[model samples]
Target chain A: MKLSEDEIRRITLTAINEMGDDATPELVKKAVSRAVSKLDTQPDFSKSTSSNQGRLILTSFGLNQTGVVAKITTELSECGCDLQDISQKLMDDFYTLIVIVDISGSSKNMSEIQEKMNKIAEALKIKIYLQHEEIFRQMHRI
Target chain B: MPFEFEEILETIKMTEIEHFDIRTVTMGISLRDCVDRNIEVTKQKMYDKILKYGSNHVKYAQEVEKRYGISIANKRISITPLSIPLDAFKWEDFVEVAKTLDKAAAEIGIDYLAGYSALVQKGFTNGELELLKSIPYTLSETKRICSSVNVASTKAGINIDAINLVAEAIKKTAEMTKDQDSIGCAKFVCFANAVEDNPFVAGAFHGISEPEVVLNVGISGPGVVLDAIKAAGSCDMNHLADVIKRTVFKITRAGELLGRKVAEQHGIPFGIVDVSLAPTPAEGDSIGDILMAMGLADIGGPGTTAALALLNDSVKKAGLMASTNVGGMSGAFIPVSEDQGMIRAVENGSLCIEKLEAMTCVCSVGLDMIAVPGDTTAATIAGVIADEAAIGIINDKTTAVRIIPAYGKKVGDSVDYGGLLGKAPIMSVRNINCSTFMGRGGRFPAPTRSLTN
Candidate 1:
């Protein structure tokens, strides 16, 4: 539970409620729970248990283990990150991990987590960057 | 009054409409260098390339999508024609590349990969011959890598010898992937004339004449067309034709204007606007649905060919009338997996290759996304290619085949192309072999000229 469970429920319900006026609280609660469950089941985020989600990918310097991709995915997941969609490929030895992750649930200090992830990158010897998902999607638009 | 007629024409031209937007921005990448002398290295190379290029496309396309209101339906990619690279390496290496492509695509948001291809039309390039030999392995190794053998092309003419090879390869590829779920690989396209800038899968690859990297959008909206057609009703066929023409004209205009805007926003010259009514899994927007709405209960049933022909003619008439910007095959696509209505008909034993071939007389890309048995021969595949090409030549239209022979699939099986193309039960091919005719290796004379000297 990144934010308080109550707050999480409130925000999700608000979104679902706003989507349609007749949207039931039960339906909103259920959809948000399901979405959270999906996020929880993600490969990297599955093991994480953080009350305050805090992280930002500062830069991604090509993939090294899957190449460097695991580090990026793990660092974000550890801080409660959710990937919306990703379309990446391998080119020679330098692995590139281009992805669009939704970090909206993280209510903790985002800059702190970003610095922490940068430190993690420094430790793991990988490059990671922090950019919005909207930017990521636009870059790939055809 | 005559001057008023011109004003009305201008007003009609100014009547702009917008519907659905582009979904995926698919970027095709060549996986050739990824192949290595060692099978393991080749596999590794294959895996590595998909992850790299796929991510690049996602990152770039999203930026463009926000600028233009057109939402990319899918973020996708295609690869280079694989036979040359595979022949330069080994057949098994093709499998490695397929695996790489599949995994890489999985990592990125890209749903499909094109360019698992072989060119057999102008006799077999050494790479193509090797590719023909490796169909089963290639089919079995990768989940997403689509395969297509060019059995006939306008520039290369028809190579009956290679066509024979394709029929054999079709069977082998079908068998290899049967257990893995019939793959979404677009396997074969018969082309009377092939364009260089197509952006659809199972068939999209950068031809030699392609720019460094071009952007093209395949705007699909059969739902919009069908709604308009339904409003028009069943009348004398010619009357319906006029209605269809007007509707297609409007639809093409919408696609062209959007395509141009998106290209401009991206700082890339807008290539061609493919005004094809590509169907999806949705109920309202299928080409098959439109056909049935035209009075045929079954897609490949009795009047299917006639309906398809009219649809084709009217779409072209309207599309040509709408925009000078049309480039790709600008007609309806008849892929079984993409249209739910099509899948239902096939599952009910209502459609067959015979009827589908008949319909190919009018389709933009000939015989797209067809799945066949594993034992089908490349020669038979070649025969199928030639049959489709014959229609295109006679009509002087661009037709392509993106056939996927499920490696181990048999008649009456099924596959899901996922996303926009959707899923469909596998339709069976007529159990006929064509080795003899394909063995006759020569070009059919070009179609008769239309203009008088």
Candidate 2:
């Protein structure tokens, strides 16, 4: 969590923007010092808490159509799954969607969620795959 | 935060478009404790041990697949070579043991069960000879049993007598299963320096040195490597090697992670990860395709062996870096019938048995899945095995021969064994007679290199 000189400058500029006309050199310096100290004391919360929740990735592939995301997310929400991230792209009339969800909060088990997802995929005429997040991490990271 | 969208997309693309997968998750179960003086009792003990240790193997592998969105193509089991425990029994008893293995494999829902094997690198024991004699009948009678015989090693030289016997047994197996394109030969392999922890089939068997039960994973991705090379566009040899090494590192890491998870789930030790570029008959998944991507006009051409050496070395280096324990035949596999690109090369006359032999000198395995004419002599088959064994012994690397004598078939005829075994066109062998050389049945002494002590 070390802040570079560039990052400190950016923080100082942001503090100035917040202070407006009241921004003086001494006041800005004080704000910058406080900010640096606060960052030093706080551990990287995102990194530390990343594995606290169960993570799942859902991918779908099929013909391009409307409301595919809406239909899928609605089903996910109904299962008490929280959508954490999503990316979708369409090329040559073919649609591909990759959705990451935090399933720790989900009321349903993995198999039950899979069964529901499979039915939705069948109804939509798309091939949907659900896998845990660790797979992607293991494959992509060293 | 460093995991980019592009990387995720690449993994997905490899799986969806390139047929990337964990080829096999094999559970190696040692059956040394199942020995008994009574043949039937020994057979019963083997069945019970395999059932007890491997009943949940397939289910656990499936769970890992579902969790990771990765496909595990096969769940298999390998036991200690059967000869050790059944040595006191008759040849008929070995067949009964093969039947028991096949029954347990079917009952436990595994595709193949390996370990119907004998080790006679130097010389054969009575029990080893009995097991070797039972190979044809056992393989023809059973559906899921695979067998291997280690006939040579660097430390013990070549067992010429054992090679001759195995060659004859292979011919007999083909004759017995000629109705099905001699499919039984596909289940047998003769090794020069066989390893105990190989997770790939037709040769995989739990060695006596291994623990009671362990999980070994074989990862295959010729498609992924090809994609990475294509993405690199054009580069120097060093840069190309770097690209392959980096790509293989990622692939092996993924396999190691999955293997550890599966082993943990099964409460067993995680054995080695075999990072071989094992190809299927699927289009775009061929090792030959990888060579073609490397600017080769055709496989088995002038530069094929050099390209293979580079690919194999890069794979091993990257795999070693990615995992603490990397063993088995961790190199590029060039099985003729199993790889579609190789099949095309053979059919087009660009590749031949001679060039394939030369390639095996540098690649992982030896003359594998090759189909010869029905009229091939057992002496000629022995010559082939001896040649491959000499290369392995001199180089001190594991080599195997899994050739099929296609019965009632000659050159210009192709036999289709379907699925992973694929189709192999009958390739002509050298016409020079080696009966005089093979007639002198004796041990080929260990090489000068064996005097390291």
Candidate 3:
């Protein structure tokens, strides 16, 4: 399905923020274009993600507040989320963030990781959602 | 924003770093090639050879040190130990030879002279034994010359037979120069395969294989690097590594520039640039002080080994990056008595031979500036030198020993060498006598069997 300009802006901002780039319109556009181009030629990268760990692609939204998206990082660490990579974007308001966490072999199950993340979002009142690294790759297609 | 040079530049404004220029550029010349039959002709040939090759050194070093704003300390020369046995006429023949060397050095404006040596290891030759017997008088009579004798080597073992001989030499030399009130020990050195092109003395002796005339540059800038490390205080591993690499890069540049200029002007082979932290008799500039400032208050303590190892690595890496001709004992020196920090530690009973051995594990060279009891047997000294050489062979690094068995000097007493060599506190040695082990003349091949890699 063809996405609207607003939907592309939101996705691009979140992806740029996830890639630890500035959350400006220009940075988001650049990161989105680069990531999309890379996703086309790259293989499935299935084995790149270690077997004992769970992966998450973190992205920042364009609808967020003026403050930084620090809580997700804090909550992830608290829940024993071993961060493998990070991407982020910052703007006037509504920052976007994307991060990959490895929960491989952790005693705390997926529910615990999500529960802490939910509490952080409710407390700080910032939006956060997750997708597997593979689906994120597909959605990030050019 | 760029780095704020506010603090460092301000300190630079306050301190006068270029206080004294290098007083001497001593080109260590070897006499191994000058050996031949006929005593008078050989003596004449030795003088001709030294004057012919080394005359240009003083003129060139003075010009270069002037150009660079660094003072050319001294323009001097060190020859291979004359091995008096080469001239078997009498003790007087050895003394005359010293005079001839003095004349040759003076002719070149090289006031400081060394290489008046006696190799009495294993056993002295007929002429060597007599010449070694008469070195103190020979040294006292000479005008401006320094000397050394390698009474011990890993291959030759130790010549315990020369203990009483050297003891007599020291006392007489001290007595002969006592009226003149000059430091006599500065004229002599104890060696363990002494390095070629070493700019330091009286330990500076030309190795046999060197080109008759060559320029070796001993680059020293410990204060510079120590300041850099302290600036990166308490950083993580990566940051610490960065600070070390940057500081080394700068100092090595200074050494290479000065060393090359001296070689070219003198029209000699630029032998090697030794990037060693050669400590002077200065108060705060000592290598030991740098280590102590790094958290080991006394150099022989627990943190000592790690500190020395870091120092050695940083110096070599920086020098290697700075120039291609990296040679000599390009490591940190741990000479006691020479550095103020070492003397203080030894006097307070905080440093000893065992701790020095451990420091050797981290720093460069073996037990240096060690002062043993006067009554120490020849065999004991040889044993000590062997143990040090073993460390060098096993680790595949160049190490040396320059011990002083001060005559009539007991442990706990301090012997003063005044300037440069500084003053030494009497350090006692373990009473164990390993003469039997040292007497066995053979090579202990590198410890290859122990290495898993």
Candidate 4:
């Protein structure tokens, strides 16, 4: 966290007040550093962590066809999405695919990625869903 | 993989096939500051305030839905109960204010906007009386404004005079909107022990204690629970409850997460997640079916109340454990028109109003979406509301009456409103005369439950 000039001035004044009669550059530096470190260590439990993260789970399913995985992975690679995990299964002649990707590196945001996937789904006559991974963790884990 | 394969598939199945979804995300906007000496100015302020706070409600909710891959069924708005802020307005001005609310709702593209309400659980103020007198005209005139009045509570007891006046209002609303099968009555709710943070509409209001604006959510997934209970097979009640709890716990967690995300998008405070098993009219999404899966032959069966009680308890327990902000009416909702199985039971002669009343004693709401003969007297309607209120005040729970007297309709005829309103088969109400008792109305004294402190 970067402190603005006003915040730094306020912190300096507070540190000087604490250092009182022993006012010295070294002691003031120590006090200010301690306060900044303390501010960095305490967690803000009120802020929702999921909204800031860019990891998501992608699920796609459709009839068995060639190049289905290739088409999807090709799009993700082009968008700079880092695929962390991939799982696939062929059940009753239908292909079910699940992939976990970190999209913070991608050029596209969640809505943009979903819009692209929707187009691919429509072209291939398949169904695709891209959801933030926080939902899965919240529902399935403690 | 960080998640088990089955876990991912389970959530997809719940949303894609099991009819699991967030029932509503309601933004509560306070209109208290919109009061003015000029009626037109009051209406304009109310309209402007609603738009300022709620214009982006639907858009923000849709973004969250896409982000989470779960659908939000309805995006609605609730405001400070109109009667409170506009207490000095006459009956005609009240109707004008309601029309302004209806316009605001339509402009924001919401299906319903709640909080046209008053709380006269003990006695009425002059403003409340005028508001009550305006309800019929308001309901008949407005297309999207939903109204509710709390005429009883555990601490304040039942206001028999208010109940009587509300009954007459219901009759007038029904007759005035009879062209649409008394659909106006569907937009009104009369409550005993009405909750402040309820997200469900026709009964939701931004209470006086609430902040300037907040976001509250109501979750629905009776289909998911029904499927879980069926998979449990022929087990003891203990194992059966375990199945229900496990299912509800996951759903409640998801519900809270969705609610928080929606509130975050709005840059507002996240309120409570009402863990209600609200059902839709679609097949397989019926609370009645869940009861049957819990070993009842049908809803309104001998063990129906027991089944509902167990289900309601499990919902509350799991919801409480899942979220610290669990509130509203956190239990099972068994509206007749909204649940296919309940509609089937009523149509098959297996369910009656009396049985439904007994069942409401164990559920979140009372006598929801039931239709009666067009000729049902106002005294009879008052009797029904009073009975529901008595149950609520005595038990210290929330119960409501949203009954419709479908005009020119009787015991075998049904009113069909497509979409979420669904359909209601007119059921026979007892013709027993209750005016003699209704005539002697003053106030039902607060019960012993009020002395808990």
Please, what are the lDDT tens digits per residue for candidate 1 over residues B346-416?
Answer: 88888887888778776777776777765566666776778887776566667666676666557766666
- What is the per-residue lDDT of model 2 for residues B1-453, given as tens digits with 9 covering 90 to 100? 335767777777877888889999999998888988887888888888888778888887777777777788889999999899888888998999899889999999998999899999999889999999999999899999999999999999999999999999999999999999999999999999999899999999999899989999999999989989999989999999999998888889878877877787777899999989899989888999999999899997999999999999999999999888898899999988989899999999899989999999899999999999999999999999999999999989989999999999999999998888888989889968998898798999989874555
TM-scores, chain A, per candidate = 0.46, 0.61, 0.51, 0.64
What is the iRMS for every candidate structure?
19.6, 8.4, 27.3, 4.6
- Pairs clashing within candidate 2: none
- Worst window of 10 by summed lDDT in candidate 2 chain B: B1-10
Tell me the tens digit of each residue's lDDT in model 4 across B20-80. Answer: 9999999999998888899888888889888877888888788788888999999999989
State, as a TM-score between 0 and 1, how close model 4 is to the true structure.
0.91
Candidate 4: which stretches are off by over 4 Å? Answer: A1-53, B450-453
> Candidate 2 regions off by >4 Å?
A1-53, A61-64, A88-96, B450-453
Shift of residue B249 alpha carbon in model 2, Å = 1.8
Judged by DockQ cut-offs, is candidate 4 incorrect, acceptable, medium or high?
Answer: acceptable
Per-residue lDDT of B166 in model 1: 62
lDDT of 4 by residue, A18-130 (tens): 98899888898799888888777766434433432578999999898999999998998888899999999999889999999899888777877788899999999999989
lDDT of 4 at B363: 96
Indicate the DockQ of the complex predicted as candidate 3: 0.01
Q: Against the true structure, what is every candidate's RMSD? A: 21.0, 16.7, 25.1, 7.3
> How many residue pairs in model 4 have overlapping backbones?
0
lDDT of 2 at B427: 89
Rank candidates by TM-score, best first: 4, 2, 3, 1
Q: Which ten residues in a row have the lowest lDDT in candidate 1 chain B?
A: B1-10
